[model samples]
Target: MANIFALITGLIFGFGLALSGMTHPEKVLGFLDVAGQWDTSLLFVLCGAVGVTVVSFRFITKLKAPVFAPIFRLPESNAIDKPLLIGSALFGTGWGISGYCPGPAVALLASPNWELWVFLPAMLLGYVLHWYLFKPQAQKSAAAAPENTKAEPPTCG
Candidate 1:
């Protein structure tokens, strides 16, 4: 039931992205080009997303648990750390260069653009590289930490 809900939600999100022209790299690039012939259409999309999140998050967080889960499983940490900073930098740089962030990139896979062929493989490679380089260190750190001092792993839900 949870998996079905997730699939339905993902399909809706992808459809929304496609409808908003977010799956188009050129449209995204145009929005990013502040100095050149700038496009304001995506700004409305951003604003709409922010507006919905701002309104919904307040109500959503008030719930005892998610609709499909027993527990909320929210992020415990609010601290801005080195890994967060580095990851943000990398994400921003990639988005600025390619004009396709992960959500939109995945959404575009349905249509199979030429850029998607390159971007998706590169994105997958990045995931593999990050896991290979950092997963062991994370495990070691967690193992070395005292039981009471260790934090729970972050979750999306």
Candidate 2:
């Protein structure tokens, strides 16, 4: 049942990405380009997304549990640490250079362009490498860490 909802949502999201011109590399790149040929069209898309999320999340938080899930599985961490900073830098750098984040990249794959071929493989490789290198150590550290070290609950504004 969850998988069905997931597929439906994914299809809707992909269709939205396509309709919004997010699947086009040039459109995404143009949005990122600060000095030349900067396209403000995607700004509307961003604003619409933020607007919907801001309105919807207000109602979403009022629900006792998610419709599709028993519990809300959210990230526990609120700390702005070195790993977070580094990961953000890496992600931003990649987005600026390639002009396609993972979501758009996957949506763009319907056309199967050469750029998507390169970017998708590299992206998957990065994920695999991160898991291979860090997952074990992360698990070990979590296991060794004191049980009393609870992360602070996030404060809503």
Q: lDDT per residue, candidate 2, 1-157, as tens digits?
A: 9999999999999998999988887888899897999899999889988999999989998899998878776666788999889998999998888788888888977888788889999999998898789877766666687764333232231
Model 1, runs deviating above 4 Å: 141-157
Local distance difference test, each candidate = 0.85, 0.83
| Global lDDT of model 2 | 0.83
List model 1 lDDT by residue over 76-111, tens digit each: 568799988989999889988989888887888788
Give candidate 2 regions above 4 Å deviation: 141-157
Provide C-alpha RMSD values for all models, in order: 3.1, 4.7
Residue 21 lDDT, candidate 2, scale 0-100: 86
Span of 10 residues, lowest total lDDT, candidate 2: 148-157
**For model 1, where is the 10-residue window of minimal lDDT?**
148-157
- Model 1 earns a TM-score of 0.87
